[model samples]
Target: MMNDTTFETLPGRRRSDVVYKTLLDRLYSGQYARFSRLPTERELTEEFDVSRPVIRNALAKLRDNGLIRSVQGSGSIVLYEHARGDDASAGQVSIGDFQKCFEFRVLVEQEAAFLAAKHCDRAALDVIRQNIDEVDRYVQRGEYRIGKSFDFHRAIAMASENPFIVQALDRVQDFIGFKIYIARSMSLPNPVERLALINGEHSAILSLIERREGEEARALMRSHIERARDLFLGCLPLEVVSDREGR
Candidate 1:
């Protein structure tokens, strides 16, 4: 581990941005262990002398950057780990981490979608449908439920009837939760627009799966995930997803 590091207070930065950046630097320095829950919202609110919403927004930024994850009643867990100079104690989710996760998703999930086309029954598709509708409800209220989207994807993974694929996705799901939100947030800034686009994609995938069109389902799933990467991480060229779709 590297030596203990302290975050300096910067002048002229938004209070929430200050809190977010401070926490992030601490993360990059390995002050927080991966998978460990952070302080409660109340505690952070007091520590930062900010309102709950400020603390929430700050944490939201961390989540958007894929440096932390939210857990029910447990607060956010730190996921980012990085090295500076000779300090190589690794754990944080950098752009490199995001890209690696995206690559894995493209690899594992595309096949999962393909297999799901062959094996998915009405029950499995119903789970996805329910979750997608729930997501739309959240978006309608101008909120984004990252967990809901994760559930939708996991439903597809389960429909594949492949334990190994399901296991692999579960391993990285906590982190995947953040990226799902971030990509959706950036690619579709308007809640209504995002709701329509996300549900549309899910519907298309499910339709192809129901028809047992494995190859088409596979390609569309790959493209869908790649579209997210392009939106959130700029992994592919700009033209890979035109502004119309990303918007």
Candidate 2:
């Protein structure tokens, strides 16, 4: 049986909790069958009269809880039954798998950052600078702003002048954002130090790009991503480390 108390705190829930209860009832009643596709984002937005971001947040929560999976280029599919036996539910990432993910990121983002330096327009540079400033503000205020940080990276990726790189970044945005958020939330001591390091790296990359130093930009990006991989590994629990290695 689902934990009623904990369920009330889910993303779609409110003080009144109508949406939470409705969804939970439907889920338990099997209205969304195993392996069935959920309503599209547009459909859900229309049905609920909520903004797309709110709907996306709700779906993200569902996905994290193993109730659903969003297949890229397709749509969200119900995975409740499958999750009963799925390793994903345990939130494990193997070391090798984690390294592979970082490797892939380095390969793509270094080129993307270099191209962004080579081809980015003044307007795009302004956006990137603004994002960096936003991160600075959040850090100075001791505010946790993982979303803003992710947006900064996304802005850089979009400015890369490569459509494929933009698409790839978009696909992993949620995963990357959530992992950072989780790491920050779980930190025992001075999370600000780590966040500051990240901010400094962002500034370095942006500065290189603004100077039209493509090779320097690529080098900085590679270092920045490798650092992120290390931080993520440090933040993961022992059990999750095993899972990450397996992946």
Candidate 3:
């Protein structure tokens, strides 16, 4: 849930406009992942202390901008598909590339987890645990919160005590981030359940890591990435999914 204090009283700006832009920034920044439900109109009204009409107008603007779609009895669902880029003409990555990135993560992140289990200190493990907790809060609020999800994976890489592994993961971070968004988007009507399950996996892997169970952590990480890859690819058009297994 968005903090009540997140809304600001901008001098001379329309309340609806401020609300719209604030929500837009959150959508673009992955605070509200694609396909996740925005807070209810009443909830927004209370949070922003604005009239219901103002919240409706703000949502209308979001719909007009192709940022969200309204569902009868279901509130607004996010439609912002990718991260914002410098140019409007930024090239879209091929679906194949998305799958390949998952493959790369499975190969590298599994080993990273393995190494982290052996090399991770209490401080580093704490960071990963914190990321999991953050995701839990967002899930409980019915948001996917992809940014923290990425942080969880990156923290594991850092915990591996291998700078090269961390750099390697960074190279594909954006693509993998999109994969998370798309997967969660496809899980509409039950996104919270899906997110909870994924976060559960994160907690399970964290426990294994904390116990210094390197091989078990490696296997779990492999399964985790592979499962995520399959879920995301399942949402794509048949021809767009280049991997034979994905098809």
Global lDDT of each candidate: 0.69, 0.66, 0.74
The CA lDDT at 206 in model 1 is 86
Put the candidates in lDDT order, highest first.
3, 1, 2
lDDT of 3 at 218: 100
TM-score each candidate: 0.63, 0.61, 0.60
Task: Give a tens-digit lDDT track for model 2, residues 50-164.
Answer: 5576567666645644456899977988765422235553343456666776787788899989999999999999998898888788689664445456676778888988889
Predicted candidate 3 versus true structure: per-residue lDDT over 19-133, tens digit per residue: 8768866774569978999999999988887878888877875774456889999999987764445433132345666766788889899999999999999999999999999
**Which one wins on TM-score?**
1
Residue 53, model 2, lDDT: 69
Q: Judge candidate 1 at residue 109 and give its lDDT.
A: 94
The regions of model 2 sitting more than 4 angstroms off are 1-82, 87-91, 174-189, 244-247
Error at 77, model 2, angstroms: 16
Evaluated at residue 7, the lDDT of candidate 1 is 30
- CA error at residue 170 for candidate 1, angstroms: 2.7
Name the better of 1 and 2 by lDDT: 1
| Ten contiguous residues with the weakest lDDT in model 3 | 238-247
